[model samples]
Structures are given as structure tokens and as C-alpha cells.
Target: MLLLEGTFPFVAGGVSSWVNQIIRGFPEVRFGAIFLGSRPEDYGDMRYALPDNLVHLEATYLYEPQDNPPVMPVHAAPETMPMVECVHKLFETDMKHPDCAELFAGLMDEAGPDGKVSHEVFLYSPESWEFIKKSYRSRCTDPSFVDYFWTVRHMHTPFWRLREVAVRCPQARIYHAVSTGYAGILGVLLKHRNKRPFILSEHGIYVKERKIDLYQAQWLKDNRSVFERDPSRVSYFRQLWIRFFEHLGYVTYQAADDIVALYEANRQRQLLDGAPMERTSNIPNGIDIQRFAPLRAQRSALPPPVLCLIGRVVPIKDIKTFIRAMRTVTNHLPEAEAWIAGPEDESPEYANECRELAHQLGLGDKVKFLGFQKLTELLPKVGLVVLSSISEALPLVILEGYAAGVPTLSTDVGSCRQLVFGLPGEDEAIGASGQVVRIADPEALGQAALALLTNPQAWQHASEAAVKRVEKYYSQDMMFERYGALYEKNFKWQA
Candidate 1:
């Protein structure tokens, strides 16, 4: 049996999709999912239906305060005493301190040969809290140490509870973490305790994605504590939160037996952060080609030269860039229509900004903001699909566009070039499906899209090439085979 923690049965994110792929890939292994959440409301219907291979499902919420606090020794063993000192240092210093790196490496070196990791590292250490309070007062001039201390205390209190929960879980041979977050850390802890192998797979870089969210998230600002000194800098609370995420990332990298990433960029980051190069692997995300195959058969009733953009309306998606491109595209092809097929009101402020840009550009109805609709129903209507996202990692939308026989014009990010042009005949020519433009460049995006819409013969060549490329390199079956091998090899973890 394998214990799968955190992402699978809980959150509806890229990590959750990876969790589903793994479970669905291996049916023989009995997998138990330990879902961790902070609040009852956050635990929804788990939109990704649990697969039959899932033998056990258990959930723990961090928001519920523990009924009984575990006791910690005023002093620990000699071997463990330095860990206490390390914890104090960790809680006191900001992330990126070279000392933090040395201390974590030293702590890992101190783990017992039996792999019995002491819980003292995560549990409340009086020495650590005292240092934290003292450092909090002196260093955190903006937010009073009193406020920062409580914030740190609240964010980390869950790790202690997670430790207790892991100890109670049914013994499993392998531990797989969907991503390196709190739940991933629990998997690390469990593997150390049981001496089992731990495999971590990440679809998107969690800490990086979380950092993006944290920077834009309004909730942190609403509750920011008053700092007595310089208030000019960004909120101290946000800084503390980012540091915590950095710590989690570093810890996850240090402990994993193997680490997986969706792209080369993310892999490099993991290695740079602390993961050994040998332990890291890149496995691009997979899509069910069969699902889109049938959809491709149904052609659009609309006329040719239709350009569509399919993605969330988030700022990162750069919907504004797409709208800007639409303004220039209309100059050559008056009959051509560009459809912005996604949620229009993701961020009311951002949405308003997009609409205002369109109005200023004088494109009254040239770019239509259609609300969210099923891609299966909408994708066929479009001939040329555009992805203007500034940041991405093997977007599933592009794959869907390919499978639907719709050529794409995407920003040069993640695996776009590899997806369009098959890697030099390790396989034959898997035709170039679309053009890759520099991100955030409206004119280049417009020109590339114009080429596809204007030339039918060129479009045909690209579409055929796209189908071959997907069949050769981006096939879901190929992905399943690779992941299946990885899971099978580590199925029987040694404790």
C-alpha cells in the first residue's frame, strides 16, 4: 500500500490532476489518500472523482485547534539538541540566509540510521520560540514582533498536527506527495519514520505559483499587523508568509528521494534551491487524446479565419495582450473574428482594465468576452487558437487545440516549441503546428496569427503536423507508460 498525501483528494489544481494520473495509472497498488486542508469550507466535493484504486480516504483540517497539546521536553538528547538550536535559527532568520542552508543540511545528516526522525524539529521548541520572539522584536521593525510571532506560530502550528496525523496513518510501503507543500512535508516525515521511499511529483512549481498568488492576494493586506517603524515597505506579514513558503520548498527539496517537474525551468529552480541534480526528472503533463479526438471530428459551422483565445482571465494570462493583438489583426482581415473564450470577470478590476483597453483601442465588438463554457463544445468552432500567457508550463489548452485539429499561436514559454516541432527525429517530422511569438509582444503575436488565418495551405500543413506531433511526442499513452514505470519501480518501499 502507498500513502498519497495532500493534493489528490483535496485541492482542484494542477497537482491534483497529477495525483489522479498516478492513481489511475496503477490499479494493482492499494493507495490511501491523506487530505489536509485548513478549513471545512475549503474542503469541497473534491471535483476530481476518486479512482477505484484508492483504498482509503482520510482528511485532516489544520484550522481545528488541537484538543490536547503534546508535551515537549525542556531539553532534548545531545544529538537532537542542535536541531532545537537549528529550529530557533530557522524561525528567527529570513530565508536565503546561508546559515539556514547549512543548518538544514546538518540536521538531515543527523537523522538516525534507522530513519527514525525525531519530531522535535517540527514541534514547539521553547528555545526556538524564545529566539523567534526576540528576533521578531528587533528585526521586524514594521510589524511589531508580537504580531509577527503570532503569525508564525499560527502558520506553523499545523505541522505539529500533521506529524501526529501521519503517526496514526496505516502503514504503507510507499509515500507519494502530489507537491511539496505541507502535505508533501507530511509524506517526507512519514517516509523517514517508516523508512519507506518517497516520490514527489510537481505539475507546476507550488512555491512559485503560491508566491504569485500571495503577491496579488488581498486577504493578507486586510489583516496586516501594524509595524511600529518604517511602514513604507510592503507588509511584513506578506514577507513572513513568503519566507515560510521558501522554507517549505527548501525542506521538500532536501528530503525527497526523487523530484519531478513539468519543465526544464522548474527543474533548474529545484536544483538551484537544494535538490541534488541526480534526483530530479522532467515529465511533461499529459492529456487524454481520446477525449479530444472525438471532438475534432465535429467541425465548426462558423466560417474560416476564426481566432480564439482559451484560458482563465487572470492577469498572468495577459488577456490584454491578446486584445491588443486583435486590434492589429483586424487591419488586414476585416472579415476575421477573434473570440476571447474564457471567464470575463475573473478579477473585476483586471476585467475592467481589459475592457477599457479594448474601448481605448476602438475595437468595439472585435474581441468578444464570452464567459466560461465547456471547451468540448466551444473548441471546434475555432480554427486558430492563441495563447498569450506570459508564464506557462505545458498548458493543457494547447494540447486540446492540437487534438481538435486547431492550429495554435502561443507565446514561447514552457514546452511550446517542443510541442509544435517534434524533437529532431528521435522521431520523424511531427509537423510544426503553430508559430511561437515572444511573450507580451502584441505585434509579433498579431503577425503570427495573421499568417495562419490568411493562408489556408499553410494552415493545412501545420494542422497535419500538429496531429503527428501529438501522436509521436505528446500522447497520453506515452506519458502513462513513463509514469507507470516510475510508480512500479518504487511500489515496494523499504522501511
Candidate 2:
């Protein structure tokens, strides 16, 4: 079973593409998937056609409104109060307490039928209320107890929703979660319930990304007055949310039999974040070289002065940074044009803002929003592939570009630097495939593009390096072989 959160059928991005590739790559294995999303309205039609081997697919929305049970004063069982106190202490210790796994298992047990710490008990039990109040009195610095109350309530509501999903999910010999968040927690629950092997493949560090989201979230209440607030300190509510996610991530780490990261740095991060060293490994993303290799012949001998950033139009992608870089690119090469070839439906506001910024910079027709385009058709015509994301894993686009004989210019984020310059040994000997600039630096981004596009010798060297690196290292067959071995090992254990 594959536990997915906000990726796959509903969304179209690198992770979704990877999921599609994995399902299609394994025709013999019968697969089941559970997709968790925020709400029905947030997604459109299915982004990818469901594969035949995917025998079962289920979707649940976490934020969907349900009729509330009647509010009644209830008292928690005496045994549950101790468990609740331990839960709070678990968070206090940053979920590194020796008893964390045991504590989580106990909590999961109590979430069962007529159990003391079930959802209803959490909602209306007087012991639960007193525990919340006691924690607020001791830890909350913010003035509004009401805000704290609602925030705590809102934060935990999803746990029950996920629990329900876990209860009904189809059984699989092994469970695979693409990232650690709600889906990871569901993986934890299912692992405990079924006593099955659960594996995690983290494309981006979930806790770190959630921290970024919580830090920027404007809707989280900060009741402190300007004089009382410290500009440098994060708001109490934001910190609360961060800790909550950290606790969730830590539990997920403990539950997973094997933790997979896209690269070594992230694997180390998994260790720091509580994944056992023995259980963690690295599995970089890969693409089909054969699919894109033919496009190399279609490219013009004189590369076009076109730069393309192919991904979702989300804030994390930093579309504005790409737009600002185009302003610089056009100034250097008058005929240069920037093509943003991805779906904008993910964040229409951000997309609109990017378009407005381009207009304000007088880019006019030099900047184009091509929505979504076929990479086979798009790559052959483009001179350079650009990635201006603030965060990423091993982006497949770079490898795809390399296979099509185009070099990439990307920010120094995730494994982009490694992908561009190669790894330490033979990978490094392949030579620098492209350029890597500091994140959010438009001037550096544009200048780097100019350096590659204007010089044919330099561009050819980068292109050759790109093709060699991807062909040798990041091909789909290599990725499939590794994953197939993993699945086979678990399947034998199941037998």
C-alpha cells in the first residue's frame, strides 16, 4: 500500500510524476494507494490515469466538515490521564524520550472502541480540558487562552480523521509513504495495527518544510501587542504547530522499518530527526533516458536563447525569483525569453503575482506563461532548463533536460549542486553539467544563464556532461532495480 499526502492523482508535480513512474514500472505487483488531501475543492480532475496494477485506490479529505456529536461534560478514565500527561511530556522532550514508541502505541490503543482516550474523550472529557488548561498556564506566553484552545483543537482534529482512514484502508503486506506528515502518521497507525513493514521515502524533509510553512503562515494568531512581541522570536502558536509536526515526524520515524532519502544530506537529517541509523538509506530519483534521448537530435545546432522553469506555480518554487532573473536575462540578451512551462492552478494568486511582476519589469512578451506543456516537445526547443525553487529534492526535470541535451541552471538547494557538478568520484569526473547559484539570487541566476548560452564551447561541454551524468547515474532502470529489490525483500518476509 502506498500512503500519499497531497500528491499523485490529485496533484501534478515531481512527486506525483515519481509515483506515476513507480506504479507503471512495476506491472507484476498488485498495489493499493490511499490519497489524503485537504479538501475536495482543492483538487481538480485526476492528474494521471490510474495504472492497471493499482488494484485499489482510496481518497480521504482531512479538512472535510462532518456533523459534530453533541457536546456533553465527560470525565476521562483514571488510567487515561497518566497517558495524556506522558503525551505532553513527550512533546516537551521534543519526542526524543526513550518511551516515545511505547507512548504512541498506547495512544493508538486508547483511540480504539470505547477506549479512554478516544476522539470523544479528547473533545469533551473534563480531564482532557484540565490538561489543556494546565499546559496553557505553564507554557503559553500569548494572552488569549481562547486562541490557544482553538489552535490546539484545530491541530489535533486531523488525527481522528487519519485514524478512521487507517481503520478502513485495504491491507497490504508492506506500506510505503512518500513523505512524513499525515500520511506518515497513517503509516505509523497501520504498521502498529497490521504489524507490517512500513517504509518512508522522503523527497524533502517534512518537518523542515512544515516549519517553513508554519513560519510564513499569516492565519496563525499572534495575540501579543507590538511592544510585548519580540520580532526575533517565533509566535507561541506557530511554535506550538512546529512542535506538533516534530512530534508527528519523530513517531513516524520510529515506526518506519526503512527510511529513504533522496540524497545523503537528507539521510543524515533523518538521523538527526530520530530515524535510526541502521534503518535509513539513500535512493535518488531517476528518469527514463530512452524517452528523452531522441529529443537531442531534434535540437538546433545553434541553441535558442530560451530558458524554461518547469514545475508547479507554487510559492516554494519561487516563480517570482525566476521572473526577476528573466529581467536580467533579457537585459543581457535582447532576444532572450523565459518560459514557465507548468500548471498554474495550484496557486493562482502566486501565478497572477508573477505575471504582474513581469509586466511591471517591462518584460512584456519576453516572459511567457505556457501553463503545462509536453516535455518531449518543450525540451528540444529550449536552450536552458531553470530551477529557482527555494526547496526541492532531486528534481527529475534536470535529468530530463540532460537527456534531451540541454543544460540546467539551478539554485544551490537540495541535491541540485550534486546533480550539476556531480558526486565525489567518477560522478565528479563527468565534469560540471551546469551552474548552481545561491537561492533567490536573480542577478547570479541571469548571469550564469548568459555565460552558458552565449558560448557554444562552454554550452556543449555542459550538455555533454549532463547527458553523461544522467545516462550513467540517474536512469529509470537503476532506480527501479533498487526499489524492486526492496519490495522483493519485504515480500519474502511477508511469505
Candidate 3:
């Protein structure tokens, strides 16, 4: 079973594509897929087609409002106070505390078959009220209890909802979670309840990304004025949300049977975040070389002086930075044109800002917005692909660019460096496939693009290096075989 959190179908990204690729890889093996999203309204139409091997598919939104309203006021259980206190202590203190896991186990039972602290008891018991008020008086720095009340409730509802989902999830030999958040917790619950082997493949470190989002989120209610408060003090509510995700990651880390990362760096991060090193390993993302090689035939000897950033135009992608880099590129090479190619619907506001920024920079005809073009179409025209993302995992676009006989100029993030320079062996000996620039640097990114585009000798070296590197080291055949090996070793399957 695949325990996907906001990836596949509803969203289009590297992780989503990777999930689709994995399912398609194992044609003989029947598979189950579970997709979990934050809210019902967060997604649109499915972005991917379901694989033939996918036999069971279920999707749940964590924020789906209960039809019955909040578990209503009801008779109190005697253990409610202790249960409430346990909940507070788990969040209030260190998550690694031995008691925290034990207490969470009780919460599983309480939220599960054991009725000591029923949902009603948690929602309406007098003991529950006392614990909330006590925790408020002691730890809450937020001025309004009203905001605090809703924040705590919002932070916790998904966890209970996920447990409910776990109860109904069909049996599967292995539970593989793409990222560690709600789906990770569901994996933990399934492992605890059904003793199913849980595999966690983290394409991006979930909690680290959550922290970045929470830190910038303006939706959080901050009572203090910008000038009045010290910069050291983050809004209590933002901190609360960050801690909640951190807690989920810790618990999931403890429960996972095996942990996987896209690169060695992320694998080490899993270790630092408490994943047992013994159970963790790196699985580099691979591409289908033939799928993109045909595009190379259409490539012009002198490809257009156009650079494309193929991803969502969101803050983490730093689209504005890419636009600024285009301004610099076009100024130097007047014929240069650029395309920001991906879905903008994910963040229309950010997309609008990027579009506006492009015009504001006077990149009128030189820059275009190409929404979700197939790689075959885009790869043939563009001289180089660019990734200005402030963050990434192992970006498939870089590998895809290589397979298409085009090189990428990317921010030195995630596994881009390893992919470009190759992995310190025969692969590295193949030579640098592309240029790696410092993050958010328009000047450096622009210069790198101009250098490769203006000089055919340099561009050919990079392009040849790219195709050679991808064919030798990164391919779908390798990824599929590696995952098949993992499944074979871990589960007795009817293939």
C-alpha cells in the first residue's frame, strides 16, 4: 500500500511523478494506494492516470468537517484528566521522552477501541476544559484564548481523523509512505495495530519544509506589533504548528520499519532526526533515458537562447528570483527568451506576482508563461533548463534535461550538486552535466546560462556529459529494479 500525503492525482510535482512511476514499474504486483490531503478544497482534478496494477485506491482529506459537528458534550470518563495531561505533556515537553511514546500509545487506545478517553471525553469533559485552561495559563504566549482554542483544536483534528482512516484502511503487506506527516502517522498506526512493515521514503524532509512554511505564514494571528516585539519572539501559534509537525515526524520516525531518502544528505538528516541509521538508506531518483532521447533529435544545432524553469511558480521555487535572472540574461543576450513552465493554479497569487514581476522588469516578449508543457515539447526549444528553487529533493527535471541532451543550471540545493558533478565514482568521471549556482543569485545564474548558450563548444561538452551521465547512472530501469528488490526482500508477494 502507498500512503501518499498530498502527492499523486491531486498535485503535480517530482514526488507525485515518482509515485506514479513506481506503481507503473511493478506491473505484475497488485497495489493499494492511499492519498491524504489537508483539505477537500486544496486540490483540483487528478493530475495523473491510475496505473493498471493499482487495485485499491482511497483518498481522505484530513480537514473534512464532521457531519455531526464536534463530538458533543457528554458524560466524563474518570481517566479523562490524566489523558488530557498526557496529551499536554507530550507536546509541552521533549518528544523523545520515553513516557511520550507510551502516552501516545494510550491515546491510540483511547482514540481507538479503549474507551477511557473517548472523543466526547476529549471534546467536552470537565477534565478536558481544566487541562486546556491550565496549559493556556502556563505556556501560551498568545494573548487571546479564543485564537488559542481554535489553534489547538485545528492542530489536533487531523491526527484523530488519520487514526480513523487507519482503522478502515484495507490490509496490505507493506505500507510505504512518500513523506512523513499525516501519512507517516497513519503508517505508524498501521504498524502498531496490524504489525505491517512500514517503509518511509522521504523525497523532501517533511518537517523541515513545514517549518519554512510556518515561519513565513502570515495567516497566523500575531498580536504584537512588528516594532513592539523582539524578533526573537515568533507568534506562539506559529510555534505551536511547527511543534505539532515536528512531533508527528518524531513519532513516525520511531515507528517506521525502514526509512529511505533520495540522497545521502537527506538520509543523514533522517538519522539526525532520530531515524535509526541501520534502517535508513539512499535511493537516488532515476529517469527513463529513451523517453527523452527522442527529443534530442529535434534539438537545433543552435538551440534558441531561451531558459526555462520547469516547476510550480511558488515561493519555495523563488520564481521572482528566476524573473530577475531573466532580466540579467536578456540584457546581455538581447535574443534571449525565457519560460516559466509549470502549473500556476497551485499558487495563483504567487504566479500573478511572478507575471507582474516579469513585466515590471520589461521582459515583455522575452519571457513567457508556459503552463504544464510536456517535456518533449519544451526540451527541444530551450538551450538550458534552470531550477531557481530555494529548496528541492532530487529534482527529476535535471535528470530529464540530461536525458533530452540539454543541461540544467540550478541552485546548489538537495541532490542537484551530486547529479551535476556525478556521484564521486565512474559517474563523476563522466564530467559535470551542468552548472550549480548559489541559491537565489540572479547574476550568477544569468552568467552561467549565457556562457553555456553563447559558446557551442562549452554547451556541447555539457550536453554530451549530461546524456552520458544519465544513461550510466540514473534510469527508470535501475530505480524499478532497486524498489523491486526491496519489496521482494520484505514481503512474500504473488507476482
Candidate 4:
């Protein structure tokens, strides 16, 4: 069973693409998809179509409360008091403790191999809750222990309910997690309940990505008073989210049998967060290389002095830098044209800013915002592609550029150097497809863009090198083969 949270079939993002790829790659596996959403209403008009091999589709929303009444708060009963206390104690200490596993094992209800549901065993003993409340009060810096107790209850009461639901679900030999947020945590609980292996695949660092979004989020601001008074100057709710994500990382790392990341950078982060290095694998993002391969045949016809940048019209993409670079490039090559191709509707504010920058630089006519273009239709006519992102991780746009024999001018961040220019391969003079400059440096970016426009020989060499690199390393077949090996190894399947 694959547990997806607010991505996969519902959302359109890097993680969603990876999920679609994996399922399509292995049609033999009977996958039961368990989708977790923020609200029940959020499920409306989801576009992804399920494959034939997807035998079961189960949906659960995390933000929506469970139907059953709050079952008398686990602390109310004397008989179950000690079990609750033990769980509380386990939650207090760091997850790395050897004793934590014992506490987890105690709460599990052992199901026989015959697939029979066994008698319930209390894993979270009452004693666990008492110790947890005590620890919460002491470490939490709360003046009143009673207040801390309810705070913990209020925060994790839903999680406890989720755990209850997970332990009672139908059987699956393996549990697959899409992201390491709530769904990843559910994967941990499901593994514990079923005594089955869990596999966690991450397209993006869920905790880090979510932290970035939540740090800039506006909704969580209101809950600041309930949790703490001005806890960690950067939003109390943000800290709470960070802590929750940290706990999620701990649980998922501990429970998952195989943890896979999309790139080496992400894999390293996972290892630093306590995932065993031996269990981690880096399967870089792949594209339909063949679709762009035909562009190679038309490379000779591509318009010279044409520079194109394709991506979402957002602040992170930093289109202003590209526009500023065009101002300099236009000064050098009067015939040169710069095209910005992407959806303007994504971030109207950023789009407006870029438009203003273009006019302010007096290159408004020179630069064209060809909004939301199909790259295949546009790439054949473009000579160079630029990625002006301040932050990125193996952007698919770069790969698309590579396959089209279009060299990239990218900021040096998140595998950009590695992708465009792999480590010097046997003294080949540092196989650089294009230039990598520091982020937000318009002059340097302009110089790089200008140099490529004037020097036809250099541009030709870069394009050829890019094509060679894409064919050698970044092909879709290579990614599929690597992932197939990992899945088979973990699933214990024979050819």
C-alpha cells in the first residue's frame, strides 16, 4: 500500500511526477493507494488517473477529525493508566534511544502470519502519558504542568487518532510513503502495526520544503498564543511545525526499510538527519529524453542570438536577473533577443515585477515574455537556455535543456554544477556545458550570456557537450533501471 499526502494523484509537483513514474514503471505490483489530504473538500477535481494495477484506493484526510467521539481521553481509566505512562516516557526522549523500540513494541498488537487479527495489546501504557506530561512541563518551560499537559494532548490528539486508524487497516506486505510529512509518519505507524516493511521515496525534502512554506505562511500566525507566547521570534506556530516535522523525520528514518532521495544532495541531508547511509540511494530526476532528442536533429536550424528562460513565473525563478542580463547582452549584440517562457498566472506579483524591470532597464521591446510555452515547440528555435533560480534541486527544466542540445546558464546551487558539468572526466578540461555564476549577480550572468551569444564556436561546443552528458548519464532508461533494481531488491521479487 502506498500512502500519499496531498501530492501524488492530487497535486502537480516534483513529488507527484515521481509517484506517477514509479507506478507506471512497475505495473506488476498491486498498489493500494492511501491518500491523505488537509481537508475532505481538497479532494475535489483531482486530475491524476489511476493505473490498472492500482487495485485499491483508500482516502483519508488528516486535518479532518475522525468520526468517533474522543474516547474518554486515555488517562481517564485506571486499568490502562500504566500503558499510557510508558508511551509518554518514550515520546520524551530522543527517538535514537534503544529503549524507545521496546516501548513501541509493547504498544503493538501482534498479528499472526495467517493474517488473523489478534487481541489488542496496549503499546502506549498509562505510565507513559504521566511521564510525557511531566517531561513536557519541565522541558517546555511552561509555568503550569496542567497547561502543558493539555497542550500536548491538543496537538497530538489527532495523531493518536490516526495511529488508531492505521493499526486497524487491512493488510499489505509493504507500505510506500510519498513524502516524509504526515503520510511518512503514517507509514511508520503502519509498519509497526502490520509488522511489514516500509519504503520511503522523497522527490523533495518534505520537512525542509514544508518549513520554507510554513515560515512564510500567514495562517499559522493566529495559533501563536495557544502554543507559546512569542516562542522563537520567527513565529511560534512555525517552530511548532518545525518540531513536528523533525519528529516526523525521526520516526520515518527509524521505520523505513529503504529510504530513497531524488539526488545526492537530498540523500546527504537524509543521512545527516540519522538515516543509515547504507540504506540511502540517489536516483536523480529523469525526463522523457527521446521527446527532446529530436531537437538534436534540428539543432543546425536553431536561431542564433536567441536566449530563452523557461520556468514558473515566480520570485524563486528570479526572472529579473535574466532580464537585466538581457539589457547588457542587447548592448553587445544588437540583434540578440531574450525570451521568457512560462505561465504568468502562477505568480502575478513576480510577473509584474519582471515586466517592470524589463521596462525600467529600457529593454522592454528586446525581451519577450512568451507566457506558458510548450518547450518542444519553442526549444527548436532557441540557441541558449538560462536558469536564473536562486535555489533549485535538479530542476527538470535543466534536463529538458540538455536533451534539446541547449546549454544552460545556471546559478551554482543544488546540483546545477553537477548536472551541467560533471566532475572533470579523465582530463577533458572540466566538461562545462555553460557558465555557473553566483546567485543574483546580473553583471556576471550578463557577461556569461554575452560571451555565449558572440562566440559561436564556444556555443556549439557547449551544446554538443550537453547532449553527450544527457545521453551518457541523465537518460530516462537509466533512472527506470536504477529504481527497478531498488524496488525488486526491497520487495524480494525474482525475475
The sequence of per-residue lDDT tens digits that candidate 1 reaches over residues 1-495 is 333444556543345666677678778777888887776664556657889989888888877755533665643344565564566566455444545544553454444322223435334556555656666776664435556766766885766567667668887777777677786677667766677778887766768777887888787642444443345666777777887787777776766778988777779978876677898998877777877888766864332677888765778788989889987789998876778776544357888888889889888678778865677888778878888987777777788788888888999876677777656775335568888999899999999888887887788788778776666667777788877777767765454
RMSD of each: 5.7, 1.2, 2.3, 5.8
Clash pairs, model 1 backbone: 142-227, 431-465
TM-score of each: 0.77, 0.98, 0.95, 0.77
Instruction: Please write out the lDDT profile of model 2 over residues 1-495, one tens digit for every residue.
Output: 999999998899999999999999999999999999998999999999999999999999998888655787777889898987887787686477766865786687677547887788888988889888998999999999999998888888887788888889888999999989999999988988888899899999999999988888989989999999999999999999998898889988988888999999899899999999998888889999999999999988876899999999999999899899988888879999999999999889988999999999999699999998999999998999999999998999999999999999999999999999988999999999999999999999999999999998899999999999999999999999999988887777652
Question: What TM-score does candidate 3 reach?
Answer: 0.95
TM-score of 2: 0.98
- lDDT for 269 in candidate 2 is 91
Best by TM-score: 2
- True-vs-predicted CA distance for residue 208, candidate 2, Å: 1.2
lDDT of 4 by residue, 34-89 (tens): 88877776555554788888788777776675453333423223434455455555
Encode model 3's per-residue lDDT on 236-324: one tens digit a residue. Answer: 88888888888888888877777889999998888888787788887788988889999998988875688988998789999888889
Question: Which of the two, 3 or 4, has more lDDT?
Answer: 3
Candidates 2 and 3 compared by TM-score, better number: 2
**Whole-model lDDT values for every prediction:** 0.71, 0.90, 0.84, 0.72
| lDDT score for residue 290 of model 3 | 88
Clashes of 4: 22
